[model samples]
Structures are given as C-alpha cells and as structure tokens.
Target: MTTLADIAETQRLAMLSLSQRMADFETHLKASPPGADLTGLHKDFSAFKEHVWGVFSALQRQIAELSRSVDVIEMRHRKKFLLLGGVPESSGEKVPETVASILQSKFGLSDLAPSSLTVCHRLGSASDGHARPILLRCADSKIRDLIWRTKTKLKGSSYVVSEFLTRQRQTAFTTARKLFGVTNVWTMDGVVNVKLPDGKRRRVFSVDEVVALGVEHGKQLDQEAPPESSSNRKSATSPPSIRSRRTIKKK
Candidate 1:
C-alpha cells in the first residue's frame, strides 16, 4: 500500500519464513526412524493375520461338525428305505399290481395293503437308457427292515433289493469292495463294513475311515491275496431284485 521498497522488504521477510519452515520439516524427517516404524507396523499386521487365521480355523471345524451331524440325520431317515433294481420297463403296465404281486410272492409279505406303502416310484425319465431302480418307502420302519433283511433270500434271483445308502456312503462301499472284495464288504442300513486283519469286520461310515484302513493295512491285505470266494462273487454280480414301483432309487 505504500512504497515499492517497503513492499519488496515484506516479500523478502515472507520468503525467509517459508524457507525456515521448509528447513525445519527436513530436519524433523531426518530425525525420525522410518525403518523402526515400518518394523512395528509389520509386526502388528502379522499378529492380525494370525488372529484371522485362528478364527477361520475354528469356523472350519464348526462347519465340519455340523456337516457330520447332518449326514447322520440323513442316513437315519434312509434307514427305512430300500432300492429294488432290474425291473423291466413296459408301457401300460400296472405298477401297483406288480408291486403287490412281488411283495406277496417273492418277499413273502402277507396281508400288505396299498396303504402300507408310503412312497413308490421309478426314479427317473426313461431316456436314461438304464433300467430304472424302484424306490420303496413303507409306512412302518419294521416293514422296511424286514424287507432289507430278506435281501439275502433274493440272492441269485433275477431281482435284488439293497439298503438305500447316501452317495458318500455308496462311494465308501465301493472303495471297500475294491480293497476287501465283495464278500468282505457289505452294508447294513447304509453302514459300510470291511473284514479286518483279525478276521473281524469293522463298521466304516466315512471315507476317512476307509482311507485310514487302506493306509494302515492295505499292503498286508494285498500280500495276503484275500480274494472273495466264488459264491460271494456270484451273489454280488447276480441280478438285483425288481419290485413294482415308479420311485426308482439311485444305485
């Protein structure tokens, strides 16, 4: 607002103040130990990562436990169910009549009414090219149990009935069969069994159980060449039972 010399003096003073501030900033930066701070930050992050992993691990364990519980419940529900395989498909066939006949004749189930069966069906579409299995659900668990026990009676017959097992159990059954042969491996109400080294059979319900057996005694079993007897092999491959039903259970 006054003379040019006065204005220039003010400008010079302002520039000096800014330069001092810049110098101070540089000095403060130089004094600070950036590497030490970085190390502390890294340590903090590592601790956080470990804590997260621990939480995740616990969650995984809980989920695994829940899955096992669900599997057990499902297997229990299927305990009263059976699968009848190898019934020929025909058009205009009386499915209920056929079922009644089979139960009366082949299964020797007397005085069973149509209402005694809760569910019955051939499982899938005819386009699958394979013979559809029959899924039979009885009103009483006792009836189903009786039918399941009589499966051995149907041995070498054109029709066969087997316990309905979950897919995982089925896979385990197949694995046991591969290792232990047909006779040594069988299922009771979806519970898989394999003959042990001591001539005693042990129940195996999970794939892990079968895997452990293979890991522990696979070599010894193979060395012993414990092949299935000819009778058992014949029974295993023999034609499965056929019951009249549209509800086909998956093998």
Candidate 2:
C-alpha cells in the first residue's frame, strides 16, 4: 500500500533531517580546531545519523543500477571480464629487441601480461638523447611522493608523473627543458634503463634515487660523527655508559 505520495513524504522528511544534521556538523566544525577530537559530539548528533543513512541508501541504489548494467553487458559480450592483454595485431610490427629485453629484465613485466598492467609507455623522439626516460607503473599517492622526493635528491635530474601518458611526457619534457635549460634531457617509452656494475642493466627512477640518497645520508652521518657535547654522543662515548643509561632511565 505504498503510494507515490507516501514515497514523496518520506523523501521530504529525510531531506529535512539531513539538512538539520549537516547544520549541526557545520556548527561543530566551526567551533573545533583543525586537529581537535570531535568523535563524541558527532556520535551524539541525531541529524548526522540521518545524513549517513541517506547517503548509504543513495549509494545502494546506484550500485544496484550499475550491477544491472554490468549484467547486461556481460550477457551481450558472453564474457565475465574484459581482456586488455597483448598488443593489437595491427601495431605488433617488429620493435627493437632491446625494448623487449628492457621491459622484461629491468621492469619485471611479464611478456604476456595485460596492457593495463603496463600503465604507460613513451616513445623516444629525435630531439632527446639516447638516455631512456623513467616509467612509473604504479598509480598511488604514496608512490608519487616517493618519486618526487627521489627526483629532488638526484643533484641534476628531474621527474614528473601524470595519469595520462601523452600529457605526462609532454609536461616532463617541457619542465626538464625549463629547469635545466638544456635540450639534451632524454625521453622514452616504458622504463628507464641504467647499466649495472656487473655488465647488466636495471630500471631505476626517482624512487630508487630517494632510497639511495637516504642510505648515502646515513653513511655521511657515520663518517662525520657528532660533536662530543651532544647528549646522544656523550651517552655513547661516556666511561660510565651504565650510569648514564641509569640516569636517563630514572628521568
């Protein structure tokens, strides 16, 4: 016996409840400092509960619609999942063996993996030198931060990350040109290759550079040592190490 009128009334009530709850949230946010704990206050608000329920209901409806659409597409295609593996036969023309070797040996990519797994590839242009450009395979904030730190530590190198391959490379090349004011900055598709000490090659980028910088910094600290006056140094070098430790323990 649920009529359209009843549904309308229910929706109107939900909207009013949600609005009141949002107003309470806004008031709390205004009163609280940026890092203050407001969990108890949030839980006490009735309006917040209503607002959360409404959001959950809306999400459920959208998910149901998406499920139906996916079912239809799968029925039509006679496939449960879409396949994005392998290069298109049309573009499978002979490429350099070096490119293949680099992808497998350095980047640790499987020969028959899906195209999506590769993320992006940048082809070398005539203007850029022979140095292979870096390829970032992951899409995440942590990875991005790691890469940025690495780039900054690399004394004379730079890097960029973009969700889109075309735009990222173009931006990288442009930025490198401006930063170094030099045209010899390299660009290439996929991974950047560096020669190893044992006559082998490896793929490395800003992420690796950051790690190397951290290790180098640690070594430098060890070599330079610390001034004797420092509490840390005194504790380490003191004749009565146990007494110093006990004093700190008492404190």
Candidate 3:
C-alpha cells in the first residue's frame, strides 16, 4: 500500500544517489592524467561502468514508481508510454564513441590539444629501437626534456633534419615511419623531417630529432678531423706538467 508521496520520495532518493554517483565518476576522470597507462585505464572504465549501471537502475526504479502513482488507469498507461518513448538506458555499446561525442560537444575541440609530440628517427642500434612516434599531453615536459637531451647528446650523428608544422602529430609520425621504416614514434613539442642513412626520410620531432641530427653532424666532423694518437694525447696532457715545471723554475 505505497502512497503517491512514498513513490515521489523514492524517486527523489534515486535521483540523489544518481547525482552522487555521477559526481564521483567525474572526480575520478578529472583526477586521472591524460595518456595514463592503458592497463590502469581499464580499471577506471570498469568503475565507470558500474556507476553507469547504478544510475540506470535508479532511473528505472524511479520510472516504475511514477507509473504506480497515477490514479487513473489511462493516465498511468500514458505515463508508461512516455517513459518507453524516452531514450532507453544504454546497453553499454559505443561507450567510447558516446563519451567522445559528449566531451567534444561540451568542451569543443580546443580543449583536447596535445601538450607535446616527439618523433625519434634514429636511436643508436641498427634496429633503431628508440625511433618511434610519441604523443603526450598534460605535464609531460620531463619526457620531452629527456628526449631533447638524448638528441643533443647524439647531434653529431649522420642524419639530415628538417622541421614541419602540422596539427596532427600522430599523422606526422605515421608518415615518418612509413617513409623511413622507423620502429618507434614519439610525440614532442614540435615536428620535423629526419633523413636516414639509406637515403630514406621520415617525420620526427623538432627538438629531439634536431638533436639527433646534430649528433650525426658531430660524427661527420669527427670523421673529417685528424685522429689523435696516444702521443698526441700525451702531448695534450703534458701542458699542465710543463706549466708546473715553469712555475717551479720561476720560484
């Protein structure tokens, strides 16, 4: 013998629970950094699924309660009809697309700008283990800096470097990989083209790619310069000894 008031109260409670669950999900999403490990993302999405199911359950109960509250049978039938007409609770299909659409609609395209895109074309080994496309956003400057340092360290290598401007960093990397048979891709602050040893070409990040190219340049310089023998090294090292002897003589 549930009264209309009781039904209304139940609906209110369900709405409140839904609101709280939605809030919690939002908090989790906000706290998570972009490009978080895929394994961790699976866990987050699992929780989100649970919360969404909870919301659907609550809403279904609310609808049932509202249908029960109508005095007239015809009126109750009409209400039921309206409820049925309403969007059905998701069966969990197209979750990614739905979420992406919602984000795009709410925040617009500009909100999702990538913080950095780095592309490494050559990484020491013949396999080019480090050459890949990398895309990172949100406080990934440390990774960018590491790539930059690596580039600078290898700047004297035998490579050609060129920079490009483009909106899609991933596309650039894909293009580079196809062109140069690169195994890895990195996203960084900017874009560039790197020429490989086999006369192949690829798109790479400006900072790190440039640094690697610089290393190649240095290598070329070393090749052109005369090699220093042990005697030459000893001569170079003898300057301090000579200076010390001269000081002793003056004393």
Candidate 4:
C-alpha cells in the first residue's frame, strides 16, 4: 500500500532531481566562453528546460494520483464510522449509552441498541465549555448510513451528524459550501457535491477540485470564499487514529 511517507519521499526525489538539473544548467552557463555561438547553446538550453518541465509535470501528476488513491482507501475504511457533534459533554460519561440515546431519540433509531456501537467516545479536549464531538463505530455500515440519512431531523437542534471525512475532503466540503452556499453544497458518502449556478452538478474529492469548481468556474478566489463569522470546521487534516480507541467490543 502507498503510504504518505512513500508519497513524500517520491516528491523529495523529484525535487532533488530538478535541483541537480538546475545546477548542471548553471555550470554549463558558467563554462561557456564569453562570446560562444549563441544559436546551438540557446537551442540546447530550450530543449533541456522543456525536458525538465516534462519530468516535473509527470512527477506531479503521479503524486496527485497516488494521493487520491490513498484517500479513497482511507475513506472506505471509515465506512462504518460516523461523527456526532454538539452533544452535551460531561466528565466520565458513558459514551456508548449517550450516543445510543441520541440515535434513539433524535434519529428515530429507537430499536438500535447501545451494543450496536462497537466504539464511541468524545473527541478532543473539553476546555472553554465546548461540547466535544463524538466518534462512533457502528457494528454495521447500514446503521451508520441510516443515521446519516435521517440527519435532516436535526435541522433545528444543536446536534449534527456528518461523515468522518479525511481532512482534505472536509476542507473541500467546507469550501464548496462557502462558494455555493450551504444549501447547494453537501457531502454524500464522503464525496463533496456542488450544484453550480448553471444547474450543473459536480462531485469533488480534493481541495484543488473544490477550488477549481468554485473559484475558477464561479468567480475570483478571493471573492468566492465567504467570510468567517464562526469557524465551522469538520474533521481534521488526517482521520483521528482509532487504534487506541478501539477498546470496546461489540456485544
């Protein structure tokens, strides 16, 4: 499997190669006699520059493809997980029971048992009276999907449930929302969906895709990113590591 480390190393090597080519070009420029024939040297330099550009572009394309592939896999692994925000936080509360109560009361999943949650807990520090979001791993993906679909019932409530997207995708989702308005932009199954003003629909994966669809297609970048009144953020740069939090076993 291609890891982020592998991608970083690939980029480092590509940059190193480009740096060497630059150094070689400098050496050639310095070694040329004061009044050497200009035509052949210019032609050679042009060809060398194009060659380096081609290499760099190819490397960039490869890295983007690799990152997308890794992102797809990571989201697939989180298929059974869901993020629940705005629940009241308390000291040493029973997370599984609390989450189950929300699922039962709010989402109309009354029949859903607390045991269905393989893992559940509040995320991050409890400082400043902020309610820490809960991360839940359902025993079945179907239940997770059901909860997400019924999220509209939470429209007026303080609670919200969202996809456990990777940070890049989360940013893309938020940027799409800012550009297109919250009504036109949303995430479905971890893919950011945007409805353009022209009545066209676009699904974006990365932040770059979001920028292209929004800023480039709609208007200028500076004009499109809406002002920040409240920093409404979702997810993180990387998915929270669940290995240590996987202590719960399904009943």
Q: Give the number of the best model, judged by lDDT.
A: 4
The C-alpha lDDT values of all candidates are 0.67, 0.36, 0.37, 0.73
Indicate the worst ten consecutive residues by lDDT in candidate 2: 238-247
> What's the alpha carbon RMSD for model 2?
23.3
Error of 2 at 78 (Å): 32
TM-score of 4: 0.77
Candidate 4 colliding pairs: none
User: Which candidate do you rate higher for lDDT, 1 or 3?
Assistant: 1
Model 2 segments more than 4 A misplaced: 1-129, 156-251
Error of 4 at 36 (Å): 2.6
Give the clash count for model 1: 13
lDDT of 1 at 221: 30
Question: What ordering of candidates by lDDT runs from best to worst?
Answer: 4, 1, 3, 2
Q: Each model's TM-score, in the order given?
A: 0.68, 0.18, 0.21, 0.77
Q: Following a full C-alpha superposition, what root-mean-square deviation does model 1 have from the true structure?
A: 20.2
- Which one wins by lDDT: 1 or 4? 4
